[model samples]
Structure formats: C-alpha cells, structure tokens
Target chain A: EPEVTQTPSHQVTQMGQEVILRCVPISNHLYFYWYRQILGQKVEFLVSFYNNEISEKSEIFDDQFSVERPDGSNFTLKIRSTKLEDSAMYFCASSEGLAGTYEQYFGPGTRLTVT
Target chain B: ELKVEQNPLFLSMQEGKNYTIYCNYSTTSDRLYWYRQDPGKSLESLFVLLSNGAVKQEGRLMASLDTKARLSTLHITAAVHDLSATYFCAVVNAGNMLTFGGGTRLMVKP
Candidate 1:
C-alpha cells in the first residue's frame, strides 16, 4: 500500500540553527498534517495544511514553525532558532479526504535532536 | 479544547489472554481512529470508527466507537506476543484536527 514517507530520518542541529523536515505524502492525498512526540510524552498535533494553506494549528505551533507544500508531493516543516526542548520525533501524515471521511497515513517520522 | 484520554497506560498479559483498552474524549466527535506503534517506529493505522455503534475487527484486534458517550474501545482477543505494541486512539474534531489520547502500551508475554 502507498504510505507517507519522510526524509532525513534523523536530524541534529545546534540550539540556534534552523532545521527543515521534509515529507512526501501519498500522491493522491489532499490534507496533510504534522505532529510531534516528545520522548516519553503523548503525540501532540502541530499543524494541518490543505489547499496550500494552514487549516489549524496548536499552541505548540508558534512563529518559529512553518509548513510548506512546495511541490505536489513534498511537504515540509521548518523550525527557526530551535531550542533544546524542540528535541522530539516529528511525524507527517496525509489523508485522501477530510479527517472524518478518510483515515490518515503516517510516515516513519524524523527524529529531531537539538543540542 | 479537545482532550483525549486512555486508561491503563501500561498493560502486561500472557499470550492467548484477552483485554481491552478504553479511550474517552472530552467533546463530541463522530470520527475515532486506532493506531499501533512499535518501539521507535511510526504509527500504523488499525481501525477507523466513524459513527455510533461502529465496530471493526481485524485479526486478533477489535475496535468500537460510541458517539453519544464519546468513547472508543480496542479489545484484544486471544492475543499473541506479536500483538504487543503501543496503541493510540485519536478523535477528529472540527477543523479536521485529530486530538490524540495517551497511548496504551501492551506487552504480551509468551
């Protein structure tokens, strides 16, 4: 079956550096989302993207975070000026239809490590 | 705000036993999903319960949702060692945002 895929399975960056996590959603999927799971913590929603715009975002998604679907299949999340607390596993997901209509498929996730 | 809660975060059972994981959400939602995650792995979709009295079963796992009660359940039957994993239930609220519950980690000892 088709699945969401992410690049740079592991990312290591300095505290003040910028990092971009990339994802390639399923070709026919429309809605995309980003979520993060801190070590030993529950997975938290970050943002949702549809029609090249953000549909919803959580308080955790601050100014430092931005998402882009630069191309048809590529979705990316960028974080500027990362903090130590930013270390977590970032996951990308995509759905063929809206949340209530279809199930979302999740990628393996990119482990972000800030030092 | 939407809040999802799961009970008995950790469970250990012997192979061939049976158990259930409960998920409760704070608000009204018709769509609920169950996912499984192995250690250091990605989340895998297991079942989607879209309406009240919705039930879906696969292999040794079964899931059901109650929209009126805002509750969803994942029941394991004749569990095996391979069924051990962290299971999460997420409710899709307005704006198509999914609120996730604290996952239940199941360890089936053979």
Candidate 2:
C-alpha cells in the first residue's frame, strides 16, 4: 500500500515569507493535486497537475501560488508572500489516472502556520 | 459547476445504533468517493463508488452509489466510538478534480 508522503508536518513562518510544501506521491500515480483546509472548514482544492503541467486550478490558486513536480517523485507547492489567511493544513493527493474515474490517495498533510 | 451536498451536517448516536449519511451531487459523473477526517488530522479514504448501483462494505459501514439519482449513501451499523469523525463525499468530474461536500460530523458515544 503506497501512500502519499508530505514533509515538515508543521511549518511556522512570518507574513511576507516564502514557503514550500513538499510531497512524494505514490510511485505509479499520474495525477497530483493540492488542497487546503482552514480550521473547522471544508477542504478546498488548490490545483491539479498532470502531464507535468497544471491541468486546472481554483481561484484560490492565484499568482501567489505555484506547483511543480521538479523531479520524478516530488511535488512541491510554493506560496509567495504568505498571509495570515494562508495558515492552514495543506494536503497532497495522487491518483493512478486522470480525473473523472480516478481515486486519489491523500497525504497526511502539512500544517502551515503564518504569523 | 459541480456541487456536492451532504445532509444532516451533524449526527450524534450511541453505541449499537444504526445511521445513514446522505450525499448528493449535481452532475452526471459516475465517480464518487468518501473520506473520513478526525479532528486535527488528514483525510482518510473510506470508499470509492465507481458507478450506478455500486455497493461496497467494510466492517460496520456500507456505502452505495446511485449514479442515475446522482446520490450516494454511507450507512453505519452498530456504530462505535471509533467511528466518530467528519465524513466527506467528493464528486469527481471528468476533469479528474474532486469537489468535496461540506462533510457530516458524527459523534458516537458509549
């Protein structure tokens, strides 16, 4: 049972700082995604990656956010000039195929705290 | 736009009780998924409903999908404390991205 793995279980940063969350998706997965959950709120989608490029992104994924595979196993999400509202649990998910019928496996998540 | 709606946003039950949570979506997609999240934790995969009339069971929980009706249900039998968590159902459109429901918070007491 291969699982999605995220690093830096907890991250604390000051406002205006740049932060990167890392993930290692399942070995055979082709589609990758990023989502965030504000405390006590429903999880929100950020962006999805396939074919080494962004397939789709939510409005929340603005100029301030970017994602990259960078390497074969690592998927990274970078937030430029973090804000207080950016503090949330960031999750990484990967699936065997593209959207529609694919089932995604989610990572344990990285808790990002901005002060 | 695809919207996943779940009813009974909050549920509280005692041990040995049976309950069902309902999830509805507005679309024609056939792929649906259920996930569980405990407080201060990440989402855990529960069930994947691939098509109409698909039913899968695990332990004390069973999930069924009715694609024609654009609905899914997760039923728990003899619920226990361990089953207490926030359950969410997500609809996967053809794009492969998932639109998750608001979630149903369940509290099972002993």
Candidate 3:
C-alpha cells in the first residue's frame, strides 16, 4: 500500500538555527497535516494544508513555523529558529478526503533534536 | 477547546488474557480513529469509527465508538506479546483537526 514518507529521519540542529522537515504524501492524497509529539507526550496537531494553503493551525504553530507544498508531492515544515523545547518527533500525514470523513495515514516521522 | 483522554495509561496483561482501553472526548464528534505505535515507530491506523455505535475489528483487536457518550473503546482479546504497543484514539473537530488522547501503552507478557 502507498504510504506517506518523510526525509531526514533524524535531524540535529543547534538552537536558534533553522531546519526543514520534508514529506512526500501518499500519491493522490489531497489533504496534508503536521503533528508533533514531545517525548512521552500525546501527539499535538501543528497545522493542516489543502490546496497549497494552510487550512488550520494550532496555537503552537506560531510565526516561527511555516508549511509549504513547493511541489506536487513535496510538503515541508520549516522552523525559522529552533528552541530546546522544539525537539520532538514530527509526523506528516495525508488523507484522501476531509479528516472528518477519511482516515489519515501517518509517515514514519522525523525526530528533531535541537541542542 | 477539544480534549481527548484515555484511561489506564499503562496496561500489563498475560498472553491469552483480555483487556479494554477506554477513550473519552470532551466535545461532540462523529469521527473517531484508533492507531497503534510501537517504540520509536510510526503510528499505524487500526480503526475508523464514523458514526454512533460504529464498530470495527481486525485480528485480535476490536474497537467501538459511541458518539452520544463521546466515548470509544479498543478491546483486545486473547492478547499476545506481539500486541505490545501504545494505542491512541483521536477525534476530529469542526476544523478537520484531530485531537489525540494520551496513548495507552500495553505490554503483553507470556
């Protein structure tokens, strides 16, 4: 079965540096989302993208965070300046339709470590 | 704000035994999903309960949702060591955002 895939399975960056996490959603999927989980914490929604635009975002998705679907298959999340608390496992997900009606498939996740 | 909560955050059961994980959401939502995640692994979709009284089962696991009560249950029957993992339940809100519960970790010992 087709699955969402993410690049740079593990990323290490210095505090105050920038980093980009990339994802290639399942082919033919329409909606995309980004979620993060602090070690041993529940998954928290970051943002949702559709039609190449942000459809929804959480309070945690502040000005430092931005998402872009620069190409047909590549969706990326960029953090302008990383903080120690920003270290977490970031997961990219895709769904064929609205999340309320369809199941979202998650990627392997990129573990971001900021020191 | 929407909140999802799972009870008995950690469970330990012997092989061939049965147990259930409960998920309760604070708001109204018709769509509920159950996912499994192994240590240092990705989340695996297990069940999608879209409506009230919806139920789905696979292998040794079964899940049920009750929209009225805003509750969902994942039931494990005749558990095996391979079933060890963390299970999460998520509810979809109006903005198409999914709020997930603090997962339930299960360890099946022989």
lDDT of 2 at B38: 93
* Clash count list over all predictions: 0, 2, 0
Q: Candidate 1: where are CA atoms >4 Å away?
A: none
Best model per lDDT: 3
- CA lDDT, candidate 3, residue B1: 91
The residue-by-residue lDDT of candidate 2 on A32-97, one tens digit each, is: 999999988888899999999999999999999999999899999999999999999999999998
Cα lDDT tens digits for candidate 1, B1-110: 88999988999999999999999999998789999999989998899898899999999999999888889999999999999999999998887788899999999999
| Whole-model alpha-carbon lDDT for candidate 1 | 0.93
Question: In candidate 2 chain B, where is summed lDDT lowest over 10 consecutive residues?
Answer: B90-99
Tens-digit per-residue lDDT, B21-81, candidate 3:
9999998997999999999999998998998999999999999999989899999999999
Ranking by TM-score: 3, 1, 2
Cα misplacement distance, residue A1 of candidate 2 (Å): 2.8
Which stretches of candidate 3 lie above 4 Å from their native place?
none
Candidate 1 per-residue lDDT over residues A1-115, each given as its tens digit: 7889998999999999999999999999899999999987789999999999999999999999999989887999999899999999999999888845688889999999999
Q: How accurate is candidate 3 locally (lDDT)?
A: 0.95
What TM-score does each of the candidates earn?
A: 0.97, 0.96, 0.98
